[model samples]
Target: MSLLFVSASRTCRSSFSRQHILLSTSRFQSTQINPEIHQTQNQQTKADYPSSSSSNSSRRYRFYFLSIAAGALIGGAYTFRQSRKYEGLMPEYITNSEQLQRKAMEARPMPPPVTKHITFDEGPRVNFPFKLTLYQYVTCPFCCKVRAYLNYNRIPYDIVEVNSVMRSETKWSIYKKVPILVIENEEIQLNDSSMIISAIESYLRMPTKRFENISKLYQSVVEKDEKGKLSFNYPNKYFLVEPLTNERVDPTKQVQTEKTKDDARDNDATTTTKNVNNQSSPWFFTKFFSKSKSEHKEGLVNIGSGTVTDNETKSITSYNKSSEQYKLERKWREWVDTKFVHTLSPNIYCTLNQSLNTFRWFSQAGDWEQIFPWYQRWIIVYVGAVVMRGVAGRLRKKYNLNDNVRISLYECANEWVKAVGNKNFLGGSQPNLADLNVYGILTAIQGCEAFQDLMSNTKIQPWFERMKHSVEPHFADNRLRATT
Candidate 1:
């Protein structure tokens, strides 16, 4: 029975299933899926989701492009700013150059041939009765020269020794250099050595006779202008004038008192009669009168007699010609400033020595011990000597200078000796400008014991002795002697 039911079900199932499928077809169509739906969904997903490498590459490209643009903008802005600043500064530099050239040309024009005369009032010539006050250092060659010149001329001057380290005290006094000369009751303040000499000459003009020989000596040492005029222009750029307590009377208004021709002839006749009367006296009185007259004439006319008037002496103080002594001193000065000074360098052992000596000479005394107490004195001296020696050696290496400097110096020394030879002064019998000029160099060299030894051992000693003897007589202060 079960087999017969299975067979019958199988045959009926096929038929019945087909009939049911057909019956359910309408319901199935309402819920049926489109064939292109899956394909369209896949296409949208492909457009939205790319491979990881491709998306990363696109993001990196965009970021790189943005960064490059930003960097270029920053660089361009900086360059523009720098160029603008440079353009603004260039014109100022060019203008400054043009201005400097203009000033230099203006300063160097040829001076006029004849300077207009400057006149001053006359009186019982105010015997510039004041002593000059000078602040100086013995070691400074310039100071030594200035002082020696003043002393040689027998100019009334007082000196105040100034330590080199204490230069600040005089910073505002003059042009910040040594040999500052001050004259009382006068507004004159002289700084440069050359200028000081000129001022001295100007003041000496009043008592010219007394300085006649000295004036001549000074005139021999300077260079002259084409017009044969010797003028000393003060190097000071400006000067200050201070008010005087009293208003002095102007003497320019004074009337001249002249003798009439007949009156002058009568006076001459009277003077002759008096002379005749004196001649007729006893032989002893006559001799005394003659001697007195001779002495008076000698006092008025003689050089080195210490009686010549200032006016006579001043006529000789021209700047165009230099004295023989001045010529010699200048040669030495040139050698030192130009040749030896250029050779100094810090590499040599002698450099330390020079540095130490300079420190001692120019620095505070106490400061040396505080800074370099361990440095021996001999060490310091050695260093200084070596430094100079090194400098000399370098100069010898660099240039083939004329060996005549030493010879010329010696010859000058010899001449100076001969001029003052056996006499006490270079002024023949009196101290004069030549002696002053030469002594400046001599005094500078004399400060060093080694230099002194060198001079003494050489042919210079004899000349030095002559100068020493010639200047001794003028050392006494006659005014003080009279008071005593």
Candidate 2:
């Protein structure tokens, strides 16, 4: 996910600029104090004792020497830190991108033949219709969610790396966000993680339906205020539209249900904004997905769970949301989105050193020029580290997180493990959406200190390994399939 962080370099620069004035003021004040002390000592010397002058002189000399020594020590320490090896620092954008691409190309191995399934549980091969191009930040959880969902459904797609700073790739679009998907054949531009997933899923289920018509089902409602400022709202974004009536196939109350849900959502957003930092926008992945996953708690969230008659053929595909299996699915998905995801930011950005290390990993994994440039990498690393360090503190207070963030992470993992209890996955034999979601979120921080600690501390290792084995094959398959 895109972390909402204050610009650390800008903060440091502003602070440095103010230091000059502060230093000048301090020097003038010190001069004023010294003169007063000298005048007082001289008067005392004249009245009481001749030895007072010598004692005052000795004290002044000692104070000057001590100040000099302290300054020298601080200067030496700073010089040592600055002069340390910068050879390992980030390379120029072009060079780094080329190297990374080349390495990926070299390391990628071809998948087995379509006829030859690696595992017995390999689902039926899906022949995707149109080419999909996804623009996203490499480390974004929502982007990862889309990727995981696509891979899980065996859909082939391409990726465009959008510059995190400039975001020039999406400049043409009004909804400025990562995880923008362009369906080439229909020329459809899909935004929002949940909307994208729902639209695509609807298309997949009803392949005979028009792509444009499917896109219309998830259309966002835009309104203008008295000041002419536009506000966009997506209601029942996840519900698939019926083919004939062009209405959302919702199982709940018919009229005004969407409005009620939207109102509740608006209220939640307002509350979250007022309470949480404006930085909460970057955490949209977890919030949106969690809301969708609240189906079990709120009696199903307009998912296509009930049987609907096909207008053209009169065919019906039975889907019962009230089923125990479906309920379990919703439960696990909610747990992953809400509880498990909340632990990530707090633990990964727990401390200054930890945040720095996390950025170092991002510098390696993220797009070279766009996300982490050569010159900007170090600045981002230091600045992002400090920013996240403070952000973690705020998140802890907002979420009521534990004193030790690692404990929170560990507890979350343990909960997942306990839920999986005796089974290989929540899906029993195979990995479910919940399993994939959790695995993908955790995978984002795999190289960081949090992931390592999570593996060592919790009993989630076995299930995590199983998930990796199951999900990785599909990723390799997707990559190799793209080449064809």
Candidate 3:
């Protein structure tokens, strides 16, 4: 099935130039956060993927304990979350038919993103500022998180599907993870789904700053395990890089900003100019980033003067353009990585038949079938199904998930819904990073029995539908690939 799609997609493929790559409503090639987050062969990027485990039990327990604490804080925070009651914004290009088609998608969500042979002459919805390439597995939740962020923002990008079995497509790097985004011009390689989203998001918020400089702020802490294997911990994975006003804005670009201001009036349209919002309030940015988990307290903004304010007071009153919202967004984004994402795999692959069906679905969606030899495809489908079934079993025990699995999934959705409260999204009004993280993670399992159950059983359906309309509008094919 994948072979047929890939073969047909080739006829519609457009080639690219060497200097840059583009992507984003959108990220894939997805999940990495803590080096330990890779415990599940179902490694989730806030969104997660299937995994085969060699990780120690202690680490898993520790991670979940932290996750629980974070989840609790989020549940309480939303009760008084002073956010807006957004009716929700529509993507610039959505059609009435696409909105209606989403109803059917609740029954059967879109398959993992892959380009099918569809005719088109026009380019992608947006042209990204930097040239980027995402090397990914179509089924990975981590990649989906990145894609969710990018595509919703309408950031256009080129993607290369990595065979989960061989991963020859990612041979150029030392890090062999799915969702490795390479910023071609700077030669910066971004690994870990949370880091990728935060980096890109930070860049988007402060476009004038050199990205290489921005990336340096998100340094990783590598530690050798008992057996000498390296585990990476990006303590700031969930935090956005604050757009500090230390750097001066380039004044010369006002002409360009003005020239394109009218063009960028559409809320979600791809913009050629620097984001105008970033320009308006650089000094007011409160550098509230966490350097280590120990010091990773949220709620207070200590900026240039290093003065702290009561988080409760700050939440109620405005401090320049900064809001307690960023912290709130980060907390839930972290939850998706630690607590929420782990629930997906057990639910999706609870039974042998479900596992087989999932692998079959994956085989049909991405270019994996076309990319792999026939024997390889057969092994991936049959062998992968058996392996994931085992992985799911172990994860259930490791995560202490509910026996029914669907209950666990529902609880996870409810947890997020509770955080969102009456707001349109966790970020409110517009979908925030947390909102994108959850949506991207779930998008991976769409069209499956688990997804159908998630929609039917949970209140998440309305928010999910709203997110779907926002991300998969009619102007862009949400099949999620730029012509290579």
Candidate 4:
């Protein structure tokens, strides 16, 4: 049993040793030559040596790819988990390095928005018809839309900031999306932002006891597809609901003549459109057709469709509703929802740094710091930015937007500017639904790089400032009271 082979002189480990070098000439075997190939031809069934070799090689390569992919995922997951230990604190290197000071500053999330309760006695400067409770993520554009409309119109409303991570505030609702405004009086829920505005505006105009009558117009049954996923449909959202009141019945008493109507339409659809291409569907939502439904991921709704009380009010005059000016407003509102909305993701989250900055604004504006633990905030900010960047790329391609992105953004701003023309807003003297829509969407990305660029490079800044001055402190106006 004590047998030993002869080593190369003294040591086999030496490179110059006989054992270290191959004693015989070596050659690689080719699959093209098989010992059995010569024995068998078309006369007999033969194994495909080359084919088998190629398949084996392909399988090995596939294994390598899977291994690398799996390793990367595992490594990323491990890193994320390990990062939880330092949730509130940055690593020493990041804190110490001056190069990463900005990033280090961004690591800390802003505190949640202030929570205030507004009761019925606390009426706004203007008479608001109802007590509304709006459930939203403060940074959501759709939520911002509702806010802008409410503020500009001098309506009183309550704010409930839903947690994007836990979403505990809105868990009671089936239709999960932001900008869910609850009409506290009739126990009714408004889902889409446009639909909410239309319903509320109609109520403000007519003061109907049966609010369900108007809200029901937007009611489309939620359909479950084969995948067991729910899809919400809102057809009448963009249409301005004509209030059924005797107030607008007589077209004969109208102030504008036919020539004035034609002039007004022409003015609303100003020639600024000639300078820009406004046809691209630039909305960032994946389901561009259902942009309202695929809006922000977390929010609230509790639909209580009560019976509509008998209101014998007559329909408005055909003159106002069927007017070209009305048509123009409706068209631009549709444009904002389908086209301008999509441009947001591409611009706001264009780069990782921009995305990070946006999410930081989100964390602060939505008040995520108080809602979730430090780790959740970290995941929401960093991981959410990464995911959103990928989404921005996809949205850019889906909408056929320009690679520069700013071009599409500028075109949209220009189109709106053109529509507004020589007036303060699209509604001539005041902001229309379209003006409010565009302004509100832009407001959500205010602190981001994209917004600064928009302000510096576009002509929309003046209009935006006016809109801001009008809509600022919307949630905390005279309408809101400190409920003890």
Candidate 5:
């Protein structure tokens, strides 16, 4: 029994040893296979990841390069557009520069030319009795009338020829217009022949010389107090003399009745005076005070009797006075300038021709027939007179002159002619302001042909014949010599 049990124990030990060996072999095989699997898995993971960060960085770089290229194209286009705009707008800059350069290259210098001098021989000092310098043109007819008047009265004067086309070196040079008279060295530029003559008479204190009949009539109509206080009567007989003479067989009877009616016409006269005065403000206190105090304190004081205190009050008052005077003066000047001048122009033209012809004949040494061929001279004169008359008519229409103003001007001119009637000038029968004034208008009229025909209707023709006889001797070319 003991031997069998010992054998069994040995057999069991052998069996356990074999099982341990088998387990060891299996562990070794498992370890080798696991190493191979792990390597394969790592490779697969690497393939799936695919280097994503590197790919994104490469795409961003490509985008940046593309953006820079597009921006460069846009900037180039913009610069080209700006260049084109500047070139189109300022073309002169290019054109002018070239022109200036060409002009500068072609420039040259020049010198002034020399001229000869003329000398005048002095003549004897004939004590010229006139105080006025009669500036006249040869072609003016009014100048002839003035000359006639002066010569008729045997007045002595210094005649200054003013050729409109010829310029003078004298300090007081006359305008292009003829008949500018200088009285006592003072220029009396008369636009109207009648006004000029009238002004001369006024200056010489002979207002009633032109129209003898009118002067006498006016004097007779003048109302005088027992003490010799002078006043005027309305609807005066003198004013109606022309109408009465035209209509009546005996004008003396009408004149007497008209003179007797003076007392009854007082109311009418007063009303007319008031109406005329109302047309414009009177030259009273208001005109003197209306100005700014700072500018005209003395003027205000003269107007207001020294009542103003504040600077503001004085200024206001002075301004009012100034405005009033300006209005009055402006109105008066306008009437004289337009109305008076236009009316007398026609009548003056007629008188001028007569005077010129008279003077020419009177002064000429040769027979009147030999002095000047009438046809040649008259034709030239006639054409010039016509154009002048047309111009005058057009001017009247354009300026809207009134007939009444013209009539008054005519009356004024008639008065002047009578005042200096037979006198050589305004200054006691010598060439004076009247001569210059009349000459200017006559010059303008004589420049045309139509005006010559108009003068034939008036007493101007005979007057001109007389004047020609008086002035012909002093002239070298009698036809060309100025009447004055």
Candidate 6:
């Protein structure tokens, strides 16, 4: 199990146990002789026997040397072929200990805060009053959404680009996903794109309160699977619960709670009563919640959808028929999440040409230049391209896409454009959550071949351009940042 090799300029030193060493007076061994050949020579004995013996021995030695040489050549060829096959298929990072230590030594301290704010079309001037750090992968769509949301809201923050392979930047967090958020004082860590956005929005709404405590609003539900692995799940991950107050709860919640208790008590006797009600009329029971004694509420306190109404039963019945604008926004947002987002990676990595084009774009547009040294940049470009090419193929199959993935991408673009239908955005005059979500996902692959092709072949260009112009004013000024 243990091996040590030592080599000098022209010779190798090898040691074997004394039992393994073979000392012989003659070059021939009984095991090495061919029985048939030996018998044939024995039959022709006693005519210059010593000279014949020497000639046979020389031929045997030559064949033994030739066999060894052939094996060496075969093994060398095999190793070279395998090595070339995997030449540039995985990313290579800077592993030099000296370089890492040097960078650490060269790092500077954080500068003092500024009172400047970013101006955007959404509302009044938005300000950054807390320390915020975002850990993300530059090319990821989910990360792109968080970035776009922060930019549009004009909340300034620092971006920490995570190494996709090592992820050394996020080592301190228990949850290993990006874009992770480390908020004020570095004690609060927020995970999941949806949860991060909700938490940030809540924090912005109430700037004076401690955002670090917002984690308690969304309860962490951990479940174990058959394999005995623990999984963390957050219910209503997108919902924000404000601090408890009486006015925040719906009045109808009290009656619903009492009715629910009575129903449970009468369950054994009421089986036929429910059947009688069903027999009397065609109806369905709808789930609606009322104001509760608990301090926390499910969603934004001011939002109508999250609150309990006066006529809770009727309200539940008419929920689907309520607001047309709300329905449309929800539909499109769902489409963006389910349909439009899936088209991106498949189209970008559709072919070998597109794959290289994407990785090359990433090399320029991403944080590679700032994070990686010169030589490592080349490794990312070449290796990332090969890796992405294989990923694109697998994604295509996973999404059950067409052979020409570009067609699916184009169709989705056209669907979105048609839905906009002469309006500036899906929300009519102003862009809504759905518009931002779609635009953010697309902006991630902005300059890549797939985006260019989609713009040219579909009607999404005008809307995309509008989105870019709309968010143009909100970009924060560039500044040096410290990594955590």
Q: Name the top TM-score candidate.
A: 3
Candidates 3 and 5 compared: the better one by TM-score is 3
Residue range 1-484, candidate 1, lDDT tens digits:
3223333434544476633543353234335535354345336435643457878999999999999999989888876665564354335523333332233334422221111111122221224455466656544556766766555455555554443443432544413467766553333345556546644543332132222222222221122243332222332211111111121121111100112112212222333323422221111211011111111243242211123322332222221122333343334334433433222222121244544554354323223232222444344444555555556455544654334234334444554455455756544343444455555645554533334444754565755666665443455432111000
Candidate 5, residue 208: lDDT: 21
Residue 432 CA error for candidate 2 (Å)? Answer: 2.4
lDDT of 3 by residue, 329-378 (tens): 66788899899889989987899999999988887777555567788788
lDDT of 1 at 212: 23
Worst 10 residues of 2 by lDDT: 278-287
TM-score of each: 0.38, 0.54, 0.60, 0.60, 0.25, 0.58
- Candidate scoring better on TM-score of 4 and 6: 4
| Candidate 5 lDDT for residue 47 | 62
Residue 289 of model 2 has an lDDT of 21
What's the C-alpha lDDT at position 57 in model 6? 94
Candidate 4 structure quality by residue, lDDT tens digits, 83-177: 55334333442233222222423442222132545433334443456677788878788888888888777676678776676676666554678
The CA lDDT of each predicted structure is: 0.39, 0.56, 0.60, 0.59, 0.35, 0.56
Better of 2 and 5 by TM-score: 2
RMSD of each: 25.7, 20.6, 29.9, 17.3, 36.1, 15.5
Error of 6 at 169 (Å): 0.8
Sort all candidates by TM-score, best to worst: 3, 4, 6, 2, 1, 5
The order of the candidates by lDDT, greatest first, is: 3, 4, 6, 2, 1, 5
Backbone clash total for model 1 is: 26
Clashes of each: 26, 2, 35, 4, 68, 2
Q: Which digits, one per residue and each the tens of the lDDT, describe model 6 over residues 128-187? A: 456667778778888888877777666666777776765666555535577876664634
